[model samples]
Target: MFVHFDRPVPGWEPADGIRTLVFLANLAAQETTGDTASSTSTERLVHRLVGSTVHDVLALALIDDLPVPPGSKLSDLGYPLVPATGDDDTELVDDAEGFLLLGLPLQEDTGVVEVEFILDAGYLPIPGEVLEAEGKHVIHRLLAEAERVARVIGRNTLQTWLLHSPDEPAGTGEFADLLREYGYLPGLTEIQGFVDIQSNIATTAIGESLPQDASLRAEIIRDLCVPEALIPGLIELYRLASVEVPHGSLDAEPVEWTPRRLHQAAKRVVTTERSMLSVLLIDDSGVIGLSEVTCHPGSDPDVLEQGITIIHPRARGRGLGLLLKRELLHAVATELPAARRIYTSCASVNSAMIAVNEALGWRVLSGGSGWQKHLPTV
Candidate 1:
């Protein structure tokens, strides 16, 4: 039995939120050791973003007749009812199995639906064949809802994308296998790498001097707030960077980072209390190179994920990429005293950025693959 809602389950409470945080933390620990954060930190985060309208969130829950206490596991709940007709008058069940959430950022028109499955992985009473059938049914219901929303939002097409661990790879893990069985084709293979900056800070000192005629100055933006005046420059620099090494997408398409879209993203990061540290290299012509890293509050506060490092085409051949990265590393070490390690991912074909990361002493962490399914337009 599955119930889909536009928001969190109607009767969801604080206890359920805590249970969810615990479940997710445990999952993160399994994927990467020592990556889990304290409950206190996570609780603060849940309170902040639980009601956010920044994304169109859809949740699928399993429900049954039993009355369960708050924070109980999904498997412990009674069996679910058959899929509903997905109308406004759908009955709200009394108790629900934990849910799987899918969200699409309202700010970005990319039409990529991000997945966040919050259900427990414990076994159920159904036979393997029956369970598989139930899983397919869940996927279909979710896709149908996603497509409806896309149509309402005026999108001609959309995709559902998720990342799986290296061990799972493509066509192997349970979820991956399920998606493949349901027509979600595998996409990009990304290589993840990490470095313990405490011991490897010296590695960032590449000793590459900037070109004498470049006249560029590098500065750190600790507050994640980009001044209104610099937005144009940042956009230009990002555009040039994308042309050289485009941002990764399921279809390997380029992104047009408009001012409004960039501002919206920056606001979201700031509101979430996540650190978006950037080092921008500016010359008289404006921003020519940029490097960024982000760390989400309550989720391995010490682990910063590398965002992007880009240098204008004209700025290339002058070691600007290394210069910008080194500056960014210094900023991270100074502002984030708790920072211990930084992780970054590069597409299997992105040799330039991979070389930059390797030059900074980053070792391979794991491999991840993106899987996407294109939804048919009605």
Candidate 2:
């Protein structure tokens, strides 16, 4: 017999179906906390191991379920249903009968919780015994369920698999050979051509500085949403010639720029201790332009230019975009040179920005289908 019950997270709805499968491992096990005579230290360890393994599988499943629209929230989907209590003897028996049947411990708690999970051979995409090994069934089930859910939601399912745990097997060559027999390959593939900050700076610098003139400087300030007091004639003198301004060069018409949003974004860039924020600008008339937001690593300053847009339409054009970016890069190199390798991502479809980044020597490091999934409220 199976027990069905509901448990909700405060201020968050429960995950249902595949989300439940993906998140079940993270859910606090009923036996994880609170006093329980039913659980021994060994049993507790087994619970943790099993829970963590399931959690990882579930995460992949959730990723497969995400919708295609950018920035879709989990709340937009139907809440997941929490698992029923597993502490009872009946549920434990059910668990043992299903996927948890292998390596059944004759004397758990007194000894180790011994069990091996089985993988269904028919479901695997890769042909090999490694994927067919025991304990792989959890991952197989997760992938199968994720694929089913993806089809229902109209999305493609990505492949996900599990390999044997490296640490637990000790130096037993047999266990290693067994995992190898299953042909399990660990880790995801690498992405190429992604831009790091050092490359961005070198490529962006055209070796031509902004011209010095009070009127031109004023125009530049007007284009950027900076405070008038912050605008100094000498600011133009420090202009690095190599920086390439993309938006300012675009033929798009000028848009209204707001100071409040600019100030807030600037504040965030200046205040964040970690290299999670950057400021960029673009100018057209050799005067004012659009400012942009970005981030880099705190430890490795060279990894600058994680682009995040804080300013929207009002500040379009004006070259402030590249200007802010140049200024921030200069600031990091001057103030925090120890850091290396900046990283950023843009939609594969944004041609204008992609052109600018290409000129700056940024490359595509990784690319995959972006998706979003939604569920109506119950």
Candidate 3:
């Protein structure tokens, strides 16, 4: 007869005459390694056999932890329980009426610490099935017993059961009803899903690049403050570069990089250079304004020439781009006297950035396309 149980008992065995099946499986592994083998071999065998059983027990324990009315079906605990089978019949025994007990290993230090229950899915009554009084009592008793078993297992516990007919309408109805009855609150459930996705993104290298400056970074915390008009030009530049390189293309000009954020990033660098006597550049209206160019104690001479830019759009036509770049280079040599190779990236499509860099004798370190995906919550 199909038998089911959901509690831990001392020296418990399955009631469906399958307890020997599990014991023999464990025995086979032990025998293969030789009973007289080293301690490690025996330990490995024991862990493999027991670790699996523990998971089943923990699954049940989790179900038992759910807050539900006493007469609820096993499925009403937010997860379904399924039957377990083994080869041995003699060791299996029907216990506490409809309950069947299965053997689980305990660490030596903690005697018989955990018991795993394998329920008979066929015998377990479903919600709205008009379970007899006896069947209801048995389920409640086993659930109560499961709580004690969980405590014995230790602070962390897990239980797992397989559903034989998950796709069947009967099983689906029971499963869905159970989840609704005992699942985490709606808000909490949504939060858990968000945490799962966000945690992974937070680990990427790009995500780690928070502005180094704390105070100035607050100004451009959101993308809306960025100049929306410049976005079209930026996107076109990105698209042209993609065509030229066919690969590594920028997916789209980032909508997140606001002018305030850029200012904050620049400010961080400026603050660092201030103590070390470095140069800063602000280009606007086709004119390059030298914000700072100075020499400081023990400052490297090569960095001074690297801090310069040509204003975009307006600076495109006049040869003023080359003139501004050359002037900055000269100022680095005569003023700060400490600078190194300049570095910058331009869209492969932006001949202007490329020309200015070339005129200043800057070599292209690397160039590639980049892409980005914007995710919106539904």
Winner by TM-score: 1
List ranges where model 1 is wrong by over 4 Å.
1-15, 25-29, 32-54, 65-98, 123-174, 203-214, 227-229, 240-266
User: Model 3: how far is 291 from its true place, Å?
Assistant: 9.4
**Global CA lDDT of candidate 2, please?**
0.32
Clashing pairs in 1: 1-80, 1-81, 62-97
**TM-scores for every predicted model:** 0.71, 0.36, 0.26
Residues 1-378, model 2: lDDT tens digits = 111123322223222321333223222111121111111222222222233211211111212232233332232124332232233222222222112211111211111112222222232323223334433544444334444444444433222222222222221333334333343222222121334446546644422223343333212221234555443311342231112222222122222223443455345433332233323333333323323223321222334444343222344465444444555555445445664544454544455556555655665443322121122222
Task: Provide the lowest-lDDT 10-residue window in model 1.
Answer: 76-85
Q: Write the per-residue lDDT of candidate 3 for residues 1-378, one digit (tens) a residue.
A: 222222322233332323322343334323322321111222222222333311232322212233333443353333333323232232223231333232343321122223233233333454336445554444445534554444444422222221222123221333223323322111110000000112222333321222233321111111112245443433343334334322222121222333554455345344323322222222322112221232222233333213223333433464544544444444344444334433343444556656655644553322222211122222
lDDT of 1 by residue, 1-378 (tens): 454433223223334433443465356434432333211243333434344544554445655544434543332123222222223223334344345555555544456665544434432212222345554554555555555555665554444444444444533556567667656776666777676666645654422334455566776776557877678888887766656663344543345778876777777776666778888888887778888887876667777878778887766787778667777777788888688877777777888887877877877755666666666666
Error of 1 at 341 (Å): 1.3
Q: Each candidate: what lDDT?
A: 0.58, 0.32, 0.31
Worst 10 residues of 2 by lDDT: 30-39
lDDT of 3 at 304: 28
Local distance difference test, candidate 1: 0.58
Candidate with best lDDT: 1
Residue-level lDDT for 373 in candidate 3: 18
